[model samples]
Target: MSWQQIQPFLVALAIGLLLGLERERSHTAGKLPAGSRSFALLSLLGAVAASVGQWTVVAGLVAVGALAAIAYLRTSEDDSGTTTEIAVLVAYLLGALAYTRPAAAAALAVVVAALLVSKTRIHRFAREIVSDIELADAIKFFVVALVILPLLPDRGLGPYGVLNPAKVWLLVVLLTGIGWIGYIGVRALGPERGLLVTGLAGGFVSATATTASMGRLSRTVASPRAPLAGALVANLATFMQLLIVIGLIDGDVLRRLWPPVVLGAILLVGTAAFVYRRAIRGPREDLTTEERPDIEPTTASRPFALRPALLLAAVLIVALLVGRWGTDVLGPNGAVLAAFAAGLADAHAGAIGAATLASQGGITVNTALTAIAAALGSNLLVKCVLAFTAGGRRFGLGFLAGMALPAVAFTLAMVMTMTMR
Candidate 1:
């Protein structure tokens, strides 16, 4: 029992004494159960025993285990439940006696003790909110973002110059990411704010889909003013989508087109606002108590499905090949027609093909612009038809009017610009 050998024991005891003192004060205030002196003595005895049992670490562990069991029995008799005091006693012994890996063991003990102490507050928070399904959905979204997107290949393949696995998957990732974010926002905000926010967010995900959903909701929901506001918001999302797509493909092109698109959207929003205001002000009898349409949260059927990615890639390759083949066979007219056909199912590939060709100097800017417009125009027509068919007459008509008017105005402006140039 040299003085130098005893120093480590005393140091361990001091550390235990400090922790026990804090616990004792907490107990005095009814926040804990054990006192400082008892803990300090236990720590000192454990450290000395550990120093003496240096040849057999198991002996020190046995001593600590016996002390912990006695403490647990005493605390159990007093409270009939609760593990805090017993845990503190065990921690004190381990901190004092666990010298082989003292620092790591002590750090872990502190963390475990803190967590045990926080159990009451943690239980209260767990009981307050957060359903099982919401938690599951959050985990599901994380799996999609972290697990799925990175696994796919990024190259082009097949007959038409069609398949780029990475690009197609990228589109899926973008749409899924946007939809998941909107779903979370809606869940947090509730339906009243959800409708407006969802419409704007959904537009970023898919404006055509948003427009269709809004139209259907309007038909069923009797609140003319709310639906009208929602519809206007959804349509505004369409212009935003246009800007987004343009920016994704070519920031320079989007920058160039910004002024006209912004001006048109502002005018459309003003008109829609005016119409809604006038309609609401006219008569109380016209307003009815229709149930709010149950707008389901958009879930990815399976965003990273291999088949869909392959199909998209196939379409793109075919579109590129057909676009090039057509341009050679029938010139600009052939390419525009090819773009229109491709646009019916998917507009992105056609637009990308045209843009690529233009960049290569194989196609003139005017021709590329015309093909892009035709592809978009064709896609818009398909959406309008689907909206009408799926949503019924009134929905169909309103959507048609809403979508067609701006589309025609934009097309005319583009046409005039092309002619002037």
Candidate 2:
């Protein structure tokens, strides 16, 4: 081979050497089987052999494979088999010789080595926490966030005038991350504290869903106070959801609304705390032994399906179109109606649609605020209905009261502000 061609091979050999040396040091420290010098020699030899030609590369692979097989055969007969070390050694030689595809081979080598080193920890983690569903969901989430979101077009379309796939998916990511954190917290609390923590966390995850769950729990259990406290906590999640929306759509709006949102959150939290304390103090008998529902990080059963996302995008387009049409026909009231109608299934979509309209000068801040408020109102109403339908009369009444009071207060506050302004 020419000297020019040999340069790339030399570089590949150097990388292999460095990695093998690290592995060798680990082996010496009781974490591996071979030393740095042995690995380095193997790597250098592999690179030289590969550089020679196809026949030389084949010969090198066969030699390494034979050595690995012998090592494994010898060790397997012993109680302390070291076949893994042998396999790693073979891999190291192969990686070094992979000059034509050095990057891919090196990456594979690193991953294999990492997997081997993390064997104990990985086993422990599997035993302690990971479930099949969680694993599947994690993989699905990865596909959505990494694979799909990036490929979508980041531009607007249709009449009412705003669509950005990147931004929308980004919002989805933000919500999923927040929901996942809350789900973890709830799961960690377990069934004993599940009701309270789940309710609070659920609010962050999905307040409406939490309310429905708690309402059902209340009906069979007869713990009015538990449902009451849970309901309050769930509403607190609504406030949080609004804050999240503001943060996602427009930070400036959040900054302006901070005072009211903070005040509202503090009141709701304090009320929930007081109710929780009272309920706990009253009776241990009231608490039942139902297993805590495993709250998913994301509400969607299927993790961010493209079909659903596309459907939502379509809905946003319709909302924008209707909102624009409403503004022209019924004025600001039409836009508010449009937002409320859209918010029925997705507050995030509604908020985004309204914000986009406002930004484009097609709607005023008051109009946007009204639309947001209406959407939230509709969303809360849906949850109330879900609680009643899914949970029963006892659960429904308690949940409705819990949700309604705060919602009413919020509505009044918004109305007064708009009027005063």
Candidate 3:
């Protein structure tokens, strides 16, 4: 056969060989049904059948399925899984697919190999790392996002002309999803990975919440540095969530707001890194016997909370209406006040409100940008208060040091917006 005609067979052979190698390696003692040679021959058979005619391909697939069934029946009752049998059929299909879509077939082959290789890790993760509560939460999350979300109406409806059930629920899902991921990261990876992972994940769920948790930990722990480090990382998630909210609601506002938000975020991250280093590594503070027990850092609980996410969605609607009213009665400046108020509860809500206003032409992009900044400023202030009250003087002071530079950056960005306009 010409080289062109033989190309599909070659591709199929390679795909089978790659998957077979992984499957073979996975078997430590009991031999698997298919090895490299067996898989390669199956692939070649499939390719030859497909090259002949449609009927030939169907007949070939049926023959392979029959063989797989026979193989399954022959295996001892103790060997319950159908993985090898399934693999054989998939390999055949992939071989046929290689004739038409070589690139796609190759990618599928790689994915299949990876899955086979990850069997041990996946089993270990399910058995040891994930808890029953976590599994149930995962199912709940999927049901909300995949099942309930699709059933909700996408268009705005209901009282006050300010509610879109689908949009609101989607946001709730988004927030919950982000928080859930963070929770998983903290749970599976543990605190050994430190603040970088914990902080970011917690921040995604709720930066302010993370800040409060960290601050409270700092008050009790002898070395407040680790908790403080995590609090700093959480700010990163806060900024990211803000950007995400803006982008989803109004891309134009997002573009306008990104400059200041990004700048402030960078400054906050830098400050956090500096504080974390000093807190964790700096010279020893002589802790008395009584104080020593208080100094050890404690673990922060999982971050995601569904009820709070629903409350945030409620707050977003309130902010939108309040912002619209402010624009209608008091003009653009009033919208800034509304944003500040909304931001005290959740900055993302205020941001979404401002972006909605901009999208409707009630305010300019500059006004929306300013409103978002005001909201962020208000949120930061709240976090600061939480730090002082919950963490006491020492923890609060340390947090202040980390937050100052970012606060300045945000102020400058807001001022710049006014000047540029």
Pick the lDDT winner.
3
lDDT of 1 by residue, 1-421 (tens): 7966666566556656666765654443333445566666666666666666764445755765676566667666455544555555565566555444466556655665566556666665456434566556557656655687687676645544444556555654554465456545544554544355556665554555666666665555444444444455665755655565556655544544565567667766765666466556755322322223344533222222445445545666666778777888899887788889888876665665665555545567677778877877887787777667656777666656665566777677666655654
Q: What is the C-alpha local distance difference test score of candidate 1? A: 0.59
Clash number for each model = 6, 1, 4
Of the pair 1 and 3, which is ahead by TM-score?
A: 3
Model 3: lDDT of residue 196: 63
Cα distance off (Å), candidate 1, residue 19? 26
Tens-digit per-residue lDDT, 1-421, candidate 3: 7987778889999988987777677765554677877888887787878888779889999999999888778763647688888899889888988887778989999988888788888888899989887788888889889999999988867544556788878877887888888777766775556656767777877888878877876655557776777777787788888787678878877766788778988998888777766765652432111234444232234444567767888898888888878888898998899999999999888878888778767788888888988888899889889888878877788788888888788779867855774
Regions of candidate 2 where Cα sits further than 4 Å from its true position: 1-126, 285-314, 419-421
Candidate 1 deviant stretches above 4 angstroms: 1-164, 223-232, 275-317, 347-349, 360-362, 416-421
Q: What order do you get sorting by TM-score, best first?
A: 3, 2, 1
Residue range with the least summed lDDT across 10 consecutive positions in model 1: 284-293
State the displacement of the C-alpha of residue 227, model 1, in Å, after optimal TM-score superposition.
3.5
TM-score for each predicted model, relative to the true structure? 0.56, 0.65, 0.87
**C-alpha RMSD of each candidate structure in angstroms:** 11.2, 8.4, 3.8
Cα error of candidate 2 at position 180, Å = 3.2
